[model samples]
Target: MRNFWGLMRAYWFSSSWKEAWTLTVVIALLTALSSKAGVWFAEASGELINSIAFFHDAANTTPLTSLLENAAFLVGLVVIKDAGITGSRTYISATLHRRWRAWLDNRFNEALLDANHSHFHAQHGAGTPAPDNIDQRVQESIKDMTGGAIGLAMGVMAVATSLYFVGQKLISSSTEVAGLEFLGSYGSAVLAFVAVAVYVPLNTWIAVKLGGMLEQLSIRMQRAEGSYRGELTTLLRRSFHVAASRGEDVQKAMHERLYVDIDQTWGRHNIVSASYASFERVYNFVGARIVAYGPGLIPFVHNRIDLKGYITGAELVNALISQCSWFIHVMPAIATLRANSKRVIEVAVAIENVQKPDEFYRRTGRSEFRRTSQNPVFGLTIQNLELAHEGHDTTPFLAIDQLRFRRGEWIFLRGESGCGKTSLLKAINGLWPYGRGTIVLPEGVKSFYAAQDVRLPQVSLKEQVCLPDAPKDHSDARVAAALHKAGLGEFIEHLGDVTRQGKGWDQQLSGGQKQKLVVARILLQQPGLLFLDEASAALDPEGKIAFHQAIKDNCPNATVVSIMHEATPPRSASGTEFYDSVVTIADGTVIKKPLQPPLPAEITEILNRPAMRQPTRSPAMEEGWRRIARLRLKQK
Candidate 1:
């Protein structure tokens, strides 16, 4: 309940709430006026009938024409009132619902971005769980709840007011002298009381239970979609051969889960809907009986003022009609209110967790030791760095003991497949959890981190290169130049006109093309430090050579520390190579010896050189021979 109030307060704080509330009040007024108008017409018609009956009993008098004239005016007024009410309610409800949905969307987006970065990654990391489907929940479920809350509140208030009016009118008339008034309303008070008591409790219980079901079904639906989408994404990333070997089984299981969930959800929805309908019918029936018996309790049989003088038949008929309409249409509205309340609570709790202040800033040593400083010589320095998983008190996962990457020097992190190479890249980029360390970065130097699987947005090939915020202006000529440097010149030309012809950058490009596009983005940004995680893996050897040359030509002073799996190394310029230092790790430990650098020419030229073509044994076959030589030397 408290959570529901907080979620609602989000709307109260927004600029739209003032207008929404004004519209709500207007609609409520319209409903009240329209309802009263309906009763007014019925009352006038009944009085006309009584006046005619009185004249017939007198046997020598003409009918009272005023009652008949009043009936015509009342009917016309009701028609006008009803039309206005319908228009006002429809417009107000729609305006408020859309406005509420928009506000909720903005809030959800804020929460998603401000959430703990490490926690987001850990829960949604590679092959662990899919993040795409949570987006559906954020976009759809939250939107429904926010919009429904407004509609539900308005509906409950309207119905409650109607019931209150009926109770007041009936009780007043029921207190009259004995006879028809006493007999008719004697049982009505007790029946109406029992109906209200029984119906409200049942409605509340069923609404709460159904709300719980919807919550579970919402989560299950997201999971099923995530599983299917994740499998498809995996297959698209890996080669056909590699994907077929392992991914087929995972996809099949995910498909099965999706079907099972759909089946269960359908059954649950049917049961809840049927239960709601049954109770609604009973509630409406009781309301009809109360309204019909109401007039009998008005003492229509007074001696001087006969039955027609005390109460008119039209009031009874009109009350029954109005009460029935209100009772029948209002149950779903109540149930929706209950459901939205629960949803609001869930969102409130999530927001609270995301907003909690960090404890890292409170520690004493943290302030002095972990402050970011400028280093003139080395591009970056990590002092006594210790890393740990977010939201856990477990032991440190990895530690980097006082490492430095000198300016204008390249370093490589080579290791087995799953040895935290990517995690290290993330930490260096300040995208991970806080650790006990001091990181010194070069003054006024910018850095960019490019991941292995580059995110290809839905736009055409050109806009994807710019990203997040659109560039001031997009030039086809500049785009072509970047593409040419990255060995994608032919592909870009084939795409035609390139501006109007393509969607943006993402929709029209393949994986290799997108990788080229990312490199184009890097060139455009031109940060001082380029952190590449297999950024060049998609290109062929010649393409890789072209890309590296282009990087050197475009961003000459920039330092590149990349994760590479190639046997050959990059070349040098003016007798000094670009990669001055190599940091290679095998089985979690650094290899001390320096590797034989690439020959001072293109890798293709180096491989084709006559000296390189000299007969060489396969390294795997020579391992036994090398072991024997080592043993012989040891003996000496």
Candidate 2:
């Protein structure tokens, strides 16, 4: 129940709760009105049958005018119920469902990007044993749960109203039944109600017992579909690698395997559902009709009840039986709702786990990390630092007793491929919290961390270059200036986007140009501290050198840390624009080797550059602008 409320209380108690409740109340009123209309329509139609029988028996006594009135009344009721009340109820219910889904989606999206990077951890086995397959839970399961709950509410309302109508019929037919005269007074209504009550319970019991494992089966089916969907997305995301490596056969085999699992789960769920569904449409459909109408016909056949009484009794009884059979009709839907509800609750639990602070950073955890600030002279300070991966525990991967960099120094982390250079850098950046350490960053400054892969989100080129900084914050001139500084003058037109016509971003830029794009991002955002984990490893040596020079020119004051898993850190012949130090890690030991003579001229020269550097309008940049102008004119 707590788990159930975890998924419920969030929305029911949220800011939109009032509006949700308002729509719900409107829907409920319309539903009651609609159900009442059904009862009236039944009553109206039954009386017409009575009127027709009267005319047949005594043509003189029954008026043709009265018969026409009854027919007109039925037509008016159908119009009121079908066209007005039912239509309003549908629109209101759909509105409520849409609002509920939107609220839940926002909640999940926020949890997926929690403060501690637990979203990243959740991808691995940090909080849950398997990947949550959260996209399926959010997209498919949410829809089923809300839609099913509303459907169940409608069924319940129908049943409740029908029982009331049935009670009125029973009261009218209180006298002794023809064949059950021994039972005396109240035999007709009392006995029929008793028989129906007993039969419906028995039917419901059979359905529940047969569908016991359906919740688990539904969960399995959901997970199976999620797996297949995740695998399909993975195949698309890595299609470039697959095509390059010619791994189509391998990808095909994996997809087929996932599809096979889906088929196996689907077969199991269907087999159970088939037996379950048969209760409603096949068994109850025929049985309920017989039970309601068959016995009522007996009295008419015996001439104990007139045709008028028989028709009215049959109408009420049929309505009652159909309402009672709702349980049998809804057994399959109930299982699906429960399954979807359970899956949603599990996701709620996972999000709860993710929203908590990292286990290492919790106040009650085993380790403690103290962070302070250092001066430009002191650079970055670290002491008693140890780095390790989250799931791997033992001795730390790398240990640092003391390390410091001057304010404007460039450094490289050099070590073997599997060593902890990248891990150590991440710890300093706060994206990694699996280590125990004290990292004194430069006082009051924003820091940046670039991942190993180039991040080109499917957005405008300006947005890509101004990433980590909104395009709204910088004007077009400033953005173009940043691009010019990074040597991407031709890419200026793609500032809004180049992904139109027959060009894709992957097609528009080469491998080296993509690295330059990251450099452009660095120039634009201009963080006081920068950590690069193979951010430029894809570039050639000359390109790498140029990337360094661009940063030195644009962000000379920033503290730079780059990972170099290759051999020794390269130093230029001038020694003015290269790594100031190299931190090497091996065998869980730390070594900082200061590279070359102390540098001052390069720093002075960079400091002397213009306060607002202007981008020289090269011919490529001018032509790019001209092209954009022509496109805008055409748009006008």
Candidate 3:
């Protein structure tokens, strides 16, 4: 219950709260006005009937002109009431819907993507497992929350207005008849209160039970749908691999299982829906008649209120309007309120659960390391770092007592498969938190991680290459040059064409081409620190060497950390001496070794090359070299 309110408060106090509240208030006011108009219309209709009957019984006593005037006014009220209701509903669905969804999407993104608090993509075996059906939760469940919340609010307002106006009319107009004093003035209101007191608890119980079942069904449906969609995505992305392995049968079997699960869950859902429909139909039909006629019948059975008399028209109109009021204003509101509340509550609880650190620790039974920021310093530092997969206390995956890398150093990190190489990269990048460690890097240093499997958005190639930064920041010439250096010169002409026709780049490019694109992006951005996790695994040996040389030549000042399974020896003297150190990780520990400097002969060859003397090194290195030269001059 506390969590539910917390979720509500989070959304209600969000940046768009003022706009959301204004819209809600407008909707509520319109609902109240419409309800009042409807009740006034009903009362005017009864009065008009009584007036016409009086004129018919004694034509000289009541004027026909007055009856006509009342009829005209009632008709106008009906039109105005309907128009206002329609306008309110339309505005809520259109304008308010967009506003609320925009706010929710942004908030969800912040909670899911924030570097400090996000557990949305935490690994399954790590801190806290991510929630299932996140796509559905963000898209469908948010829609349900907004729509249900507004509907429930408007419904309650309409019901309250109807009850006050209708109860007042019945209490003031009813009278004693046939010596039955209890069935006198206010009898209709008394009977309505009694009937409602009996009906609300009974219907509320059934509605609550049905709502719980529906919530479960909604979750099951999303799971089945998400599973099927995930399979389809995999099939599309790995079509070549599937066909090569003849795994089509296995894929088909999986599809069949997902469909069967969907069918079974939907079958149960249909049964629950049908049961609710049956109960609602029967209850409304019987309940409306009893509440409408029970008071009128008592007067008639006691030989007081007579049909075919002057009072008959008013009495009959009263009963009919009373029944319509319950049907139109009360029953549907209660029903929708129940179902929508259930859905909204479920989604709200999920959002709250995902955002809480305590929940994550309780679920995984693991303590999470707190992320901290410190003053800027040169290079990188790590002290007593220890990392293990969540829920495991066995041998740690990667452990280091102390390590440091100086500024502008090129380091190669080598390890076999499943050697915690990428895991360490993630830990350094602040993506993994299920570890104990202190890693201090230069404050506010821009860093980029190029993963093995590159993800490209469904945009033009120009946008894809210059991502995480606006395309306007880089000229077309620079983008083309970067692509050419990465060996994608052929794609230069197709830059304007959307990748995969705006479907996704995954289907358009081969694995090797994707790797080159990632490298191309890294060269384009030129961050201060670059971590490459097998970014060249898909390329041939020659291609890998060429790309490595390009990184060294293009971004000389950038501190490069490459994680590779197979190390390719550099061909040129300049390339061979590029890396300052090599680090090997084995059996959960690291061994670092400094590289031997280039020989005098190799240095002479590099010096002879005009392109190598362009001074691509950082200013810090230039200053250090100038100091060395000055010392040599003084000695001479």
Candidate 4:
């Protein structure tokens, strides 16, 4: 209960606190007005009904003409009140919902994408497994988190208003006994007190008891949904791979198992929900009415309240009961909130601050060069650095006793596949923290690491090139030059164009083309420290050579560390001694040297392009690009 309330009201303490409070107050006022309106309606309509019932009676001093006029005016006024107040309240509620959701999304996104790369760490860090189906949690649960709580709050206020007015009417005007007859006599009774002490408690107890079971089932249902959705999304993302393997049968079986979980979860939820509906909601409502009309059974009470008083009084009782009785209308919402609360909060908490270090974490090694009076270290320096996987720190796979690379050095990392080369790079980049030893990096250095498999966003070509920075901020000429230099000149003409018709970069680009795109990114970023963990392994032989040459040409001053597998040692295309040192890590040993370049061989593989169909260009369009190319060549 504490967690649930905290999650709901947390938005009020956020940066948008003023707005939150203001909207809440407005909603409260509207609820109070609506509650008071219900009482007025009950009283006025009761009198109206009495007047109409005995219209032609002689004892009825009230004329039909006056009565008709009052009825017309009262009904019209009530409608206008509803239109004015209810409409405003609804719109405000929707606005608050949207703003709250937007704020949550912004907050979550900012925390994940912070300078610390909290998102990455949240998924891979040593601790409880990361939250699953984050998008589903955000979409499904967030709606009711704020909206339902606000509604529940307003419902409380409305009930209070109703109780005060309706109870006052019965107490002050009737022959007491709360307007009910008992043992042929009447005595004073506190209708509000009785309802709060007896009726509300019973109703709430029943609701909570039944809804408790439903809450658990609701949690399971939501989990199943999130898991199912998450898997479907993953399969769709790797749809090409799945299709290439012709593993539809396997995929179907996997999806079927996941779907069965959903089906079973739904069945469990429905069982509890059905019980809740029959007992708590339907029976409770009916039983309450039976108890309520005991007053109406009395001659005097019946004459006074009639059916109208019963209804209006109910609005007050219902205002409070609505909080507990809410299951009737939004049981699933409450369940979803309870279930997804952990999921959504897990991400928020993890992203907001670093998780408290657990037993698995043992990295007291990495040390940054803090800026002091004098300039900090100029480049990266590792001392007794060791690397291991997060959970398997017992088996240290690689160790670097001492290695130093100064500014403007192109370092090659050569090793066999799975020789912990990538893990070493990750440790250097502050990613792996399982082993021991200090790795001091240059202070305030712009860094970019193109991992072996980097997932690019579905964005414009220019945006893709200028990622981790605003694409709009970069000039088309500089971006175009970078693209052309990386041998992606074919895409330069439409550099501004994004993927179309649902075909994203994933579907459009071949492996080699995608690697060239990475080269374009390195050119654009020109980071002070760059780490390429086999970033060019997908490219052909010529493409690989050209990749190195392009980097040397563009980002000449930056320190580069390229990971090269044993099958493909680092090569300098220009034959001008670009690589400063080749460090090979193999069988728990490190070899550092600079070997002479190998003789030119019969290399035949050319650049591999994507399968995307080229845009049909008119003769004029072809000539226009040709002219541009000629002009650039002439100017150079």
Off by over 4 Å in 1: 15-17, 38-78, 114-132, 160-253, 290-348, 355-371, 375-377, 388-397, 473-481, 489-507, 567-578, 587-636
- The candidate maximizing lDDT is 2
By TM-score, rank the candidates, best first.
2, 4, 3, 1
> Which runs of model 4 end up more than 4 angstroms from their true locations?
1-6, 61-74, 178-197, 284-289, 299-332, 352-378, 391-393, 570-578, 599-636
Which pairs clash inside model 1? 181-297, 300-307, 459-504, 459-505, 460-503, 460-504, 460-505, 461-504, 461-505
lDDT of each: 0.58, 0.73, 0.67, 0.68
Candidate 4 — which pairs collide? 177-187
Please give, for residues 1-636, the per-residue lDDT of candidate 3 as tens digits.
Answer: 224445445555777789878876777777667766766776666666766666667554546777888788878877777776757666765677678767776776666666544544332322433555566666766676566555555666666766666566556655554444665655544554565656656666676677667667766776788788878877887889899999999989989999998999999988977787787776666655554456556565665545322133233334334433343333333444343334445444455564555345435533444444454446777777877765645456789887777767888888778888888888888655456778777667678899888767678888888987788999989999999998888888877778555556666888899988887898899887889888888888787888788888898777878887676334443446667888888999998889655445544554446653556768776556545545554576
Global lDDT of model 3: 0.67
Q: Which has the better lDDT: candidate 3, or candidate 4?
A: 4
Clashes of each: 9, 0, 0, 1
Error of 2 at 604 (Å): 27
Error of 2 at 510 (Å): 4.3
lDDT of 4 at 507: 64
Could you tell me which 10 consecutive residues in candidate 3 have the lowest summed lDDT? 308-317
> lDDT per residue, candidate 2, 451-528, as tens digits?
667646677888878887788988898889888877899878767874856666655676678778888888888888
Q: For residues 35-116, could you state the per-residue lDDT of candidate 1 as single tens digits?
A: 5555455556556666655765655355556556656676666657666665677677778777777777776666656635
Please, what are the lDDT tens digits per residue for candidate 4 over residues 603-625? 11111123212377677765565
Error of 1 at 154 (Å): 0.9
**Alpha-carbon runs more than 4 Å astray in model 3:** 9-12, 44-78, 117-129, 177-184, 301-378, 493-497, 500-503, 567-578, 595-636
Better of 2 and 3 by lDDT: 2
lDDT of 1 at 366: 24
Better of 1 and 2 by TM-score: 2
